[model samples]
Target: MSIQMEDCLLSYKTALMAVGAAAAYYIIRWFLWQLTVGDYDRKYVFVTGCDSGFGKLLAKRLDSLGFHVFAGCLTEKGVTDLQTGSSGRFKAILLDVTKSEDIAMAVKIVKENIPPGTGLWSLVNNAGISGPLGFPDCFTRKHYEQVLDVNMYGVIDMTNAFLPLLREANGRIINVASVLGRISIRTCIPYTISKHAVEAYSDGLRRSLRSQKVSVHILEPGLFKTELFNLDLIMKNIYKDFDAAPAETQEYYGRKCLKDFTWVVKLMGFASSQFHKVVNSHVHAITAKYPKYRYLVGYDAHCYFWPLMYLPEWISDFCLDIEFVPPAGAQKKKNN
Candidate 1:
């Protein structure tokens, strides 16, 4: 072979070797990650938002794994749904995470149910609200508070209330954030803000609680086909916010424009139907001998949003803005 051809062949061989090494490393890592703490009998798990979605699924999954599950539901119907045809090990607690009284009552209930001297193995803070969808300027303080109450404050309160129990068991605390937490978008302003708070809180918590042998894990899941992602419900919220805006603001962004924007949002249907990925992350956080501090669930979360977060702000902003259709009567369009 000519010298140039020989060098090219060597480069290819070196690249192949590097690729092989990476594959081998990941294969070994996967096996190591499979190590789990297997005593399910004495372990008890508590999950919030069992009314539907991930909370309900996780509670049921843990119950199936033979752990006593304390499923917290906001409504009587939620409680009933989880209890009906479920294993006796599943204890449904009427919990409204936003209410201090309800949280206190839940603490009592969890304590009463778990065996004395045994601590809770996991406390999954899965309750969250999508909040009202609107342009950032359209939202009032109340709109932000409503989401923060459940998504941020609720997580804090639950973690604090359950810390003692978790410490006793050297347990895990799993808080559900979102891919939007890492990167902000024009939509779901309140929800994104709350999740960012969750990410911060979880990190601070993990570091502070290290001495106590309590681990905190944050789950950053992309949009999923959950009740929170219901398009009709989202549209209703958007309309409500739009109507509530000032007349001048309404005129600036006409209803037709708003509708078109929402239509664009609908077209970008990135919500994954595979709910198991999130549930599996929760399970690993709870049962693994060593769990990741942050679990980025779903391809959108792992491959898209997470990577976007690490890019330059201008670049990320450009990429995210591609999906955003300018509303009717936008000043920029008028200028154009």
Candidate 2:
């Protein structure tokens, strides 16, 4: 053979080998991804924050798949509506996660329905609030408390209450943490703290519960439209929280803070409207033979937020904060 022909054959062989290797890896992964689910038809799943958003949709998703679903909703209206819409495979419990009595009642409700051995299949912590928005000083300690109560403490209280049932079934706990949980953002301190705490708590729970065979997974999804992202509610809260501050505080921050804050809200105008991505992750975490420890859903989550999370602190700070312009008051102060 001529020298060029030999070289061409060698290159073709290398490319073929790479393709074969890639195809084999994906096939193995596909097998592992198959549902090795237990008797879901008989098993029970308790999902909180099902009154709306991802939780509501997930409860429906699991119900359709044959699991006896226990949905925890925060309001009578939500409960009534969810029940009316579902196929009678799922039951709704009035669960205000901040209330200990409510949590106890939810536990009792789920336990009473199933036989002793069936036990709970999954606990999805999906209820959360956006809380009041502003620079940290614009809100009070009470404001922070309210956000933590639902987003962070609610998850803890609910998990602790249901751990025994999950242990009995050797099931799964899927906690919904966000990209914000991994990396702090411009505002949203209380939310960031709560989610970060959740990430830490989930890590600890996963390690400790391994011997019990209760797998724990964390779902981190980027911006998506839900009540949490409702623009009217967001803008209303912004004015309500920030406007209520003392005159001095408002002047210090200036009118421009409000403008920039609204800008941030508007930026979310393009956030994904689909909730299926997160719900699908929830389903996999429950049914897959060996589910992932962390599922990063959405393009924004995988392409941007994940990488930004690992950047060095100084670099991220500059990228996220320093280059950005300050509010009008801060700018004036700098000049003076």
The C-alpha TM-scores of every prediction are 0.91, 0.90
Model 1 CA lDDT for position 265: 66
Candidate 2 residue runs with Cα over 4 Å from true position: 1-26, 322-324
Least lDDT summed over 10 consecutive residues: which range in candidate 2? 319-328
Q: Candidate 1 local accuracy as lDDT?
A: 0.89
How many Å off is the CA of 190 in candidate 2?
Answer: 1.2
Clashes (backbone N, CA, C under 3 Å), per candidate, total 1, 0
- Can you write out model 1's per-residue Cα lDDT over 1-336, one digit (the tens) per residue? 799999999999999999999999999889878999998967989999999999999888898898989999999999999999788788998999989999899889888888788998999999998887778779999999999999999999999999988988889999999888888888778989999999999999999999889889999999898888788888887888888899888887887778777886685466788899999999999998878888988888888888898899999989988866575567656799
Error of 1 at 67 (Å): 0.6
Q: What is the lDDT of residue 70 in candidate 1?
A: 92
lDDT of each: 0.89, 0.87
In model 1, the worst 10-residue window by lDDT is 323-332
Return the top candidate by lDDT: 1
